[model samples]
Target: MSTPNRVYLARLAGVAVFDPNGDQVGRVRDAVARMRATQRPPEVVGLVAEMPMRRRIFLSINRITSIDPDGVVLGSGTLNLRRFEKRPNELLVLQELLDRRVQLDSGHAGSVVDVAMECSRGGEWALSRVAVREHTGRLTRRGHLHQVDWDRVHGLGAVGDNRGTANLLAVLEDMRPADLANALQDLPDARRNEVAAALDDERLADVLSELPEHDQVEILAALDRQRAADVLEEMEPDDAADLLNELPPPEQDVLLDLMEPDEADPVRQLLRYASGTAGSVMTSEPVILPPDATVAEALARIREPQLSPAVAAQVFVTRAPLTTPTGRYLGMVHFQRLLREPPADLLGGIVVNDIDPLRTSTPLPEITRRMATYDMVSMPVVDRNNRLVGAVTVDDVLDHSLPRDWRDRDAVSPSSATHDGILDGDDE
Candidate 1:
């Protein structure tokens, strides 16, 4: 067999892997490689193949006969049918490296769009170069695609995987949720989902809440069904409700069923309201305390780590049986009011009574105007009986006030002419 000088992994993927005597065995799922310390390319360990019955098995690199644009041909028809288990020293290109963010020595960061493999004189293959593409939005089809030597590009995940590069995930993990969400927005879909999946539930929830509605839908859909429900449960009810609104009824029902009943109930209540109303955008988990509680107690409640800045800025004073939508809406106490007063002073005496609570059905525009007019970071929402049901934080209000299509302004060009060599000429 004539050994090809070079081939692209992206082109190799999905190609039919054939056995000796020209019988098809399976399709190439991924390539495994072990990094090298010297300047030499990382040796191609083997190929992971998906055969009939969706069975994934491994083919040793020693058995590969030829590398060509058509596919990989085996040295022999005999192949192991056992499940493929990843060894600690090996990395799966598709699962761990493809589409990963890589920084070149020139200080420009791009994505590993595809990997280039070359045949050695001794009949072995090694990853030689990586196709680094400047990523754009989902609709943006073409960008600058550079073929850079693998030695010049650093894998950010390698450190986390204890393979190469510095501890990049640790650095990114420290970013604020909004900042992290924005950073993830620029990545390709595969890389974005991989990063999102790596974050912890609470952190992932915070990041998801900060993302645009369309992105929220995409990321949530990418997560495991049970994991998606868990992340939704961690988010504020208002944020969770808004995300759920993006899904079709069938998917929404599936996630809701997976969530704890108590957490799911509030989101359901919010969904019952008109799309752009106070109830629909309000958080069911407001900071509420009985009127008799001391200023000291209120301050402690505000310090809870999970409380958002908007909710922690004040405490609502209510009567007993304090479920969300409490039994009675009495008054409120600003955190400033708590500061000047003695720690032992009961909240009832100094509670501010003049503040008017919003009705559940109050239109979003009115809610916005009221919040602006009163200089309030948050406003209470009440039921028909004047019972406190929830509070609409300023952040949620601001998000709703933006134009519906505001998040979609970044456009992508999908024309094929710009991405040379990335696609097969026959594909057009």
Candidate 2:
């Protein structure tokens, strides 16, 4: 007996199907898998074969013998010519599994780029593994495939069943918000929004902050106006402004009206900045504190789990009752300086004037240079009145510097491009 080797689904889809007599009967169209109760990989139930006259038939694995890269060879001389009909518990691999988004237990997610199948010791061909590609774009389609065990994927074998959805969610529940966002974007539109709806406002806001503008808009549009407003409230002013800018004026106005004034004000100010300026991409909320705040007080604010890593590294010192657009921009104190200072000492005495602040109107290139020159991860932005209005984090600056519309482009040609007929829902 020839040992079974793995074959790519894209290459297998159109391979010839032959009977024992060696006469070609049809072309392979798709594979059918039956879900099992246990953790073992799902079993390959049959193959959907397209015959002459455009007639399609289901060839149960029980009837056929070998499935190899060359073609499928049947064990019997006579073939079943009955038209193919999908059974309720059966999953069409090409139509439902391949190229579909799946969540992994590793707190990561990606599309099923391809499948690996092998003939078992018992002589039946079954899916052995799947290739999940994280990046999808012009350059990434031809990219490296991260092969994982077939059992790790959710949303495949148990199609349309609660088990699969539950398993998928279990893997996603603890995923980093940004990682979850990447996973969600790769899912089919309906499934993507379904998952997005399940995330809490704060969690969803964090995910939205990591998503591209187009995806951010799509997810927000999918949400109810009130929920969208709540999520926007949880997002940073700059990220929220970026999302709002992408919406039509009428919709934007409606959403803004639904938001609390305090939350909407900073975003409104950010929306006023021109597209490529400092004010355009700066985060209006940084960790600000009064100059008179003791080192102990500063440490407490830094300890808040909600503060992003970049914002937590430094504290902006402003004149009297610290607030955005404060009475005056005094100076800033780095977190390292705080640990060394006496707990009772005031921040005003420890604040450093070493780094220069960027004006709201500073050009994008100049702002980029300033951050790079000072090796600063977060830089303060001041208005004409010298009041601190925002701070631009390095991540945001890099995002602005990237090619426009980069997010909207695919990382690779879609997996379906190679075998469109295999993906046709009507066929299953």
- Among the numbered candidates, top lDDT falls to 1
- Please state the error at residue 237 of candidate 2 in Å: 1.1
Q: Compared with the true structure, what per-residue lDDT tens digits does model 1 show for residues 1-428?
A: 45568877766666788888788888776788777667677888777776764455777777778767687889743466655656656667655665567778877766776787777788778888888775555555865788888788877336443221122244355556865675566455766777888888989999988777888999999998999999999998888989999999899999999999988999998888998889888989899999889999999999998898999998998898678878788888889989999999999989986878999899999999998999999998889988899999998887888776444314211221211111222210
- CA lDDT of 384 in candidate 2? 89
- How does residue 98 of candidate 2 score in lDDT? 53
Candidate topping TM-score: 2
lDDT of 2: 0.75
Q: For candidate 2, report its TM-score.
A: 0.63
- lDDT score, candidate 2, position 147: 83
* Stretches of candidate 1 exceeding 4 Å from the true structure: 1-168, 405-428
TM-score of each: 0.60, 0.63
The true-versus-predicted C-alpha distance at residue 422 of model 1, in Å, is: 30
> On a 0 to 1 TM-score scale, where does candidate 1 land against the true structure?
0.60
- Per-residue alpha-carbon lDDT of model 2 for 63-168, expressed as tens digits? 6667777988887434555456566666666656655667766656667767776677676667888877654556635534678888777665544422123334
